[model samples]
Target: MDLTSNRQSWAVVGGGILGMTLALRLREQGKEVTLIEAARDIGGLASAWKIGNSVWDRYYHVTLMSDLHVRNILNDLELEDDMRWVETKTGFYTKGRLLSMSNSIEFLRFPPLNLVEKVRLGATIFYASKLKDWKKLESIGVCEWLTKLSGRSVFEKIWKPLLRAKLGENYQHASAAFIWSIIARMYAARRSGLKKEMFGYLPGGYRRFLQAFEKRLVDAGVTIQKGTCVQHVKRTGSVVKMDTADGFEREFDHIVFTTPAPAVSKACPGLQPREHGLLNGIRYQGIICPSLLLKKPLAGYYVTNITDDVPFTAVIDMTALIKPEEVNGNYLVYLPKYVDATDEAAFSRSDDDLKAEFWPALKRIHPHLTDDDLITFQVARARNVLALSTLNYSESLPPVHTSIPGVHVVNSAMICNGTLNVNETIQLAENAAVDFLKLDSRVAADVAGSRCAQAV
Candidate 1:
């Protein structure tokens, strides 16, 4: 009973955060794995850049105190020293002014909402804070649910703008459950004692975490084939056939598709227009990173949230969030804009174009900050591949195990609620590995070369 490349082979598609974490675990268990990445680097969505003897994350990624899965992985890699937690700033920019709201005093007396509205908002959020399970709330709309419970004014001012920022034009149709999940995480999880609380970061930025993962993965003997894409996946009786980018045909015993649903449809086109209809329904948004090499701190807060005042959704100052000293007189910022599938205008625009558009919004957010404070700046937009998780899009997400026997698909698109942190990615990956390894599937042992006999 021997399994060679001809007999037992496992392939992991996409070398993003999710794929890399899963690949490391699979290789440790003595499984021969091929982690294929189209990108030259391993960090996918959260990749890093080098600048003047230092590296910074493509987009800011922070580890929550509640991020246990990421913590475990860090410990496993023995990279505890590389990580350092710092208390970052969080503020709201509303109606032509910047509000430094780091405490309850600011909360009870915020300018946007009147006193009665503030009291109601407090009570409603406090109530929403309690409800962890959204099963019953899923059927209802967020607008209706919040208005009925929290009052219409609160929804119009706070929730409406917040939803508009995240989901774009699709906010009204969004599930109350989805909205509540975000609120619950903000309220329930405490980084410090404060609710709607604190966030964490690694000392050398997220590049440290990515490097740690890469080192461990290489050490674990996982074959990382970078700059390669899997073109097609076909099944011929027992063996799974793959057509790669370089016109090479690889036959595998098991295969996992960690690419986005859109990519999945392209790779396995035969399953689509029918059986795997969910793949066609999935949507996604594009994110932009605007890192400013500045002479001084842009704002006192790391997270500068926005409801109104400009076209940009939210502005993030990374230097304020991570160890500011490491940033060395430079400020890094990230701006997220939601775009539809056919609308490639935002995605197609050059980084210079993005900086042009986004630069005005920054001025609007903080008018007092002069041109002299800004030294040099660059905007880095990723070649995005993750899917948009709308309302019950989770229900529509393609599971790890496909209807077609051995094809497994797992990506951020599958994740419905909760934060899309590295920790969540690891959990999703391991669960997906179990499904592909057939550990989650109950099969009577008639292993005909990794193909379980379907009951006749």
Candidate 2:
């Protein structure tokens, strides 16, 4: 396929990581690329917001060392110094008090699971980590798989709540293969030091990541057009017919969609099969994450899980986690709630109304956090921010390539296996680029995904 036009242009829709990374990779190969985004900014859902002088994410974001793709990017961007590895805390709340939930030894001590249940659970994880092709496991439900393999107690105590939070009512039907991939993440991130389980974040927010990629894009000669919405598209033979929201019609030799799956299907309906229900079969709950700047740190731990709470499954006081001092004693909290598909009103709620409702619900978790303790608040809503990976979800996700050759799709909805964190985002972006470049043979290797395993 000849990607060269008279102007030698290639249009990349979506300015997020997948879009930016692919654009830069293509331009580095000496292709003229134009990047378009509807938002005023470039980071997509991955962008950061500022509260006074402190920068925080719309939702709490962190990466594991097992993220081979992210490791490679950080080194290439030379952001090693700008990064920090913190061994954070993970806990479960039952009837209120937080339990120390970290590592294998502590996992066994977890009151929620008995010694026998814990032993079986541990063995299951070890077995999963060594797995090569979990494709066959997709046939069974996750709940069924765990109950049969581990037992009823372990599945009820551990797997059920997590699946409920992650997949809503469809947990019972979730694929065993998908559940295994999720379990392997824990096995990969363990360590024995102060934090055998550690995470990476730039001293600042993810804006640093955006900046690094933007710099690389500029250096590679990619044209980045911000606040530009793509109004329409028409594919004519090898070249795609295009029309912008700004009322301009143009053409490109190739187009790669890094936008959300919903938007892509909406924009180019003809290219996708009506039966490919990977994303469409799944339903995503919108997030109403409100962050508050506080006068003090709410908790000592950087990360905490609120499995039992009102209006929210978890409340991440990012200020406390990243160190409140970094934000000048002002704490930032995230109040994220899952919403329905038809509930447009939830997404359109005002910030003030959100704060009024969010604060009291927050007080349920921390009673001492009075109204006076609240500093400032910001409400962020990313509609379809998380794809509902319900039971039997693995079969829904499609391969990188589609019937349309020059077109590619990548996003959070496409996290078919493993944790869909930033590290996975980077790896997915790199892998997509290889597909776009038709370089699959170059990176294929037999690496098991154990402890950040990257098997080709």
Candidate 3:
């Protein structure tokens, strides 16, 4: 095979937004791109599925006004102009009651904290937003940092429970940067030219956006292999070989593995020991988010943060952002619980078992919601969702370029700074593509030059 062609063949081994975007970018660079996904579709975390009669995202995702990368892609797909932006309210479930903490008045009256505690809590958020030194925050544990800023009362009464809800017992291992990133994004939402926290979404959720995106990719001359799993990867001379589970092999000039770190480690056995250790060292927080198709809305707030004991961390009322008419006039709610990725028992629990525990807790929060009000229930579990921002997380992250020539690993584990959302995911892919492609091109040029010199 000639290694001097201007057009290089690239394989993106993951159909998530990361891989899709990478393939599109590479194709735009005049490279022949092939996207392979193990799932039936290519959206990965942003993928949509049918729940009852409605087709919606497998996990709950909302677009923030600050999400520039996401908006850019939507613009390319001609869906940005059609985005529906809404000012949604926030709720806090605490002290056995649901309270509206969306505004100043509601927040002042919140019963979970007294005036002093509320002031301290507010100060903590304000302080965190103004702090720009995120790397320094990584040195301190989340508990110590929050308690220092908010005091013991505010930390115990509010922050601790919220931390446990999101991070589970893993909160103890997290750094103050974890909380800072969350606060920074929430603050950015209000600062994103809207001057208020405005969440936007397409009319048909991700289904419409993805269909358009898929068409755009296909039109751009990118090959998509859906339901095809890459079992192993090896480097052979100037080309990278990918072996599928079906015993199919394909060689590409370069290949990028956008799958999870563990998956990458298993697929490519030739990685250096240090690189393998770094990849395996990264910890991820999994989510078991269940979508509830309800007859009526459960609290009008888009997001209801919980400080009380509940089976789920938060209640995301999709109907708040999306009109009820969208899903057949039925409300859609997402109850997500972030668990340790290694917790097999939690992931292995049957749907019926979860229903038994989840519904009763939800009823406790809203007694009016009963079995009759429930239209249908569906669970979406991902063992690796967001990479946990541990102490000095970025310092240990494996580089996108692996030890093997022309084989790179780029996944959610590389997203160390921001929350794992569509925007951050897109940004990571765009940035990684630039760096990796430059290196890839240089390597190809070197190989071509050496071959020409040898022949001469």
Candidate 4:
């Protein structure tokens, strides 16, 4: 606990919540911490942008009642008082009709599934929610597991479309644990209170929260370097050397990489072939989300699941959950398409091109919506938003401590048992920081012992 005697300096790469959280914790433990971010601002995927005249999240994000990790961070920052919770409604766009599916009554009357199939579907959700052992579910494919439990009709009508929407072509290879975690989280939220699907959001989006977080980090004696990309990372015995894009290099006692696994391989090429292979072997699904500022609501539902053939995966009316007054009384809608990262066509499309292509589908979902109602449109793309949770995913994760001494790798890909989200990311950072500090302590002790032996 006497960290002052050790006096080790640490470099936390990547400015996402994970990196920021780890940096803060490490600093609190008396470590000299430096946070390097590639972008001008922090927050990574959780980062925000100016929408029309107001600032909002680039992609859709919500805090659930079960997100204790997120709540803890908010409490620490004293931003918990700014949280606004709302009971949201869900819609389903199937057979070319937009229908509400928020409550039991709507679900029972849903036309896609018969009464028997609906009952089977409910049973499947209940069973998944009660599941305590997720390891066994990892070996089973989602498609196979859902079909077996919910029956083929329910699987095809309900599970398949949702899986496709979130994972694109990788859904078939996903493990049953993928769906299990989602079901469990949603179930926990309902059980927490009024049995309603309520989500929380900060009044000024995450901008104010992130600004406050940056101030806290700076105030805690942490060095924050923004708009700096780390070009290379090389570990030399007890010291880790990092070279930046601007041809600047510095030495640190420890380094924590919070970027994607592939980025780690690129930064530190000295890693063993097996280590590099493990990092590179992981696949990710990218997202092209377009946030539209509209004058009116789209479907009057927070999230509208798209089951029919549509360009985008889902339509999220952020204004439905977030009050219109928050965004200058303008409705905010997000159309997100989850595609394979290798899909060049999807990634190459310009914002204007996407808007034109997706506008027709938006019209189909909301017939009342018109061009006159549109205020502005912005497109945001993330290459590695969610890791493809395939079979044996947990076994494939690389250790936090890599083969390179004084260097560590921690990112979203390591989240195998659960879905990729802010809460899970924060939890991973907290756990990784503990492991990193423990390893650093052992290494420091070993170095001191070696020096004493040499003196003798």
Task: Provide the TM-score for each candidate, comma-separated.
Answer: 0.90, 0.85, 0.95, 0.97
Candidate 4 stretches with Cα past 4 Å from truth are 1-5, 192-194, 447-456
User: How many Å off is the CA of 421 in candidate 4?
Assistant: 0.9
| C-alpha lDDT of residue 130 in model 4 | 94
The best candidate by lDDT is 4
Query: Model 4: per-residue lDDT, tens digit, 171-281?
Result: 989999999988888887774433569789988888878898999999988999999999899977679999999777899988889998889999999999999999888
What TM-score does structure 1 among the candidates reach? 0.90
Off by over 4 Å in 3: 1-5, 191-196, 444-456
Query: lDDT tens digits, residues 1-456, model 2?
Result: 333422335788899877887787777655688888888889887898787577766567766778777777777888866777777677666556677776656776788777898889888877878886766676777787788878988777666766666555646555786677776786677674433567777766778878887888877678888887876665688777767777756688677777766677666665657424543566665667777887756655555565564566566656544656667757777766656544688778899988878788767667777888887888777766656555556656655555565555666667767655666666677776666555323222222234236333
lDDT for predicted candidate 1 compared with the true structure: 0.71
Q: Each prediction's Cα lDDT score?
A: 0.71, 0.69, 0.88, 0.89
Best first by TM-score, ranked: 4, 3, 1, 2
lDDT for each residue of candidate 3 in 147-250, tens digit (9 for 90 to 100): 99999989998999999999999999999999998998998887433244689999999989889999999998899999899988999988999999877789
Mark the regions of model 1 whose C-alpha exceeds 4 Å error after superposition: 1-7, 51-54, 191-196, 382-386, 440-444, 448-456
* lDDT comparing candidate 3 with the true structure: 0.88
For residue 180, model 1's alpha carbon misses the true position, in angstroms, by 2.0
Give residue 292's error in model 1 in angstroms. Answer: 2.2
